[model samples]
Target: MKLSSFAVPILSASTAFALSKLPRPHRRAPIVHDVCGSLNSDLILNEVIDSLGRATVAGHIEVCLCLSDVVKFVESNIVAQEAVKLLGDHVKVEALISGMITGLPTGSHCSYPDHARALCTDSNPCDFECTDGYLAFPPEKPTSCKCPNHLMECDGKCGHFKECPSKAPPSRRGNEPQCAAGRTMCGIPGTSTGQPWKCVDVTTDPTTCGGCLNASPFGNAPVAGVNCEDIKGVIPGTVACGNGRCIVKDCAEGFFVAPASDACIPVPEYATVDSNQQSGEAIPGSAGSIEGPKVSRDELTAALKHGAGIAIAHFGGPVGGLKTPRDVTSGIQHGTGVLVKPVEGTSAGFKATRDVGLAHGAAKSLTAGHMGAFAGTHGIRGVDGGLIPGAGTCAKGV
Candidate 1:
């Protein structure tokens, strides 16, 4: 039978059967409608058969399909490869392949992730851990993460990857992971799992360390956990995982750097006000424990005003020789602190900000610089002279 003005022949008996069941509608060219008037219906039903027909469309032609129908079409006697190749474009080809193999429940096609490189399905019985690239699956396996290419299993704690140390004692040779076209290799050998010895690129693999298991690189020791106790050495500094590498950041105030355990311990005299330490334990402070001379808050404030230079925010630092802009990083520090909040039904608030200028906080009212009809968004502005910033509310943000 003929479809539209273009006379393409249907080669397979199954396709011909499906097309015969399609209802006759001609005004809009090609519009598929189910006999039940439902969006989803069985593939074998005749009422929705013609809905799949397309004469031709202008501009960007798009194709939407039911996963079950796709499976039915490919499984038909039609020459699947030749028929699909006739459509061309890698995207269309992938969609058909993925839809057929996914085989999710009737209405579950809408929840697919990237299916360009590989066809994925949650068929594996995951008793252990799944990787980061995986997706929502049956509850028996609560956590399921998948990847485009690698790291799709629970903690396969494969030994230190080659990119890490290169020459370690038990790095394992020839026992590398091999993945099929669409699957990634994961898991460790001789570990908790009875599974074989296979691993993926954990450095970037979200499912393995930083992404799933939360393990980070710690020198050459057997894939160390990203926690401070597991990775830190003799230096008393804070360790954080950024871009997959464990970095040493500045320790918290009042704690001295211990290079030995790579952790910060609270110093006795520096303990003031009995603050809670990093370990989540509270420590009491006594003024009698003060070994050095104490300075009053007014005296310290006076000293900062007199001695400091370069009234800038913070000095950005480099990690692994890579320097990120101060504005992009969260570590940007201001010379003085300010608080900005949303005030409702307060035209006086906007007038209050514009009239006093940005740096200084004089409390007189004038009307100007209407940010918007709703909320006014202001940024931090540069202060005028070395005037120590008061409880100044910046107007136009810099």
Candidate 2:
């Protein structure tokens, strides 16, 4: 299992100069791929595998940085320790950072509220009040806001601030809600837009809220209940506001952070079912409240676990005797890189991640970077091969 030739040429001119400056033994090593397993005589499969194999190897090589290199990489805008922690020790930390740094456009550096230690603190700076048990910001807080909730300062405006129902236009026979003057058709509870907003109408409108537009189901309704009121469930620790809203200062009796929204959720009672399965891994039910794929711990866990078998290592720098295989503490940014190597014997095995929902998205980009760094393949292209080997040429096996 000798290391292979260098997979892709180290591109950063500065990095190349730095590598040249390092002693011969410290220079970037070559990576080579060995095809000892089942060979695909089929040209298509062979071409695909051959093209993908180098990258597969590189993917495995990125996560084993020492605490020092890992910290430097984080400080250098190459990687985030928090993001790396989520990926855990099995993946390459330094190599992944190097690969990403090498591939970045000239003058590009990890930046903004997206990176670890963003200039902004997510801690809710505002004192939020649960008016009569409903979670809300003060009317002074713009009702329409896309900012991260729970952390951002909110002025505590809770409850239905809708125009008086008495002022609403007449209800039509066809189930269409007519709006009064100065109002337009809108989702109820008045979204950012000020028109007569569309209401979830949990009280009535089955198809709209829970079941029907007429009979209202407030508390216990089917999960599929169209009525907004019916769909929201009640838990013990939460304060129930009249109209339709619940304030949860803490997680439900059985849940933890849903991992997706970073919000509290119901923890599974079956934590013992599998060491792989644990609390705070699934996307909490709250995710469903919003549009788009809600980040869920369960889904994220599945993604993180799927790639665990890949072996990773830091190949260069003063890396000897340094700690490797660190945990990814937080989420990775959109284009963050991840290092990987093939599992010695098995193609797959148990995988773990700190936040499950984010695992899949982060894995994709990390794998992309792995493939690109090692095989000269595009990051997007590497995803097709799952956890294949990358360029380990002479140092490890191809």
Tens digit of lDDT per residue, candidate 1, span 258-303? Answer: 4342355444332231132223342222432212224344433332
Which ten residues in a row are the worst by lDDT in model 1? Answer: 313-322
Query: Highest TM-score: which candidate?
Result: 1
Writing each residue's lDDT as its tens digit, candidate 2 over 264-330 gives 4443332212222123232222322311123354543443332322123222221111122324323
TM-score of each: 0.24, 0.16
What C-alpha lDDT do the candidate models reach, one value each?
0.31, 0.29
The predictions' CA RMSDs to the true structure, in order, are: 23.6, 39.9
Residue 243 displacement in candidate 1 (angstroms): 4.1
Query: 56 in model 1: Cα distance from truth in Å?
Result: 17
True lDDT of residue 331, candidate 2 = 30
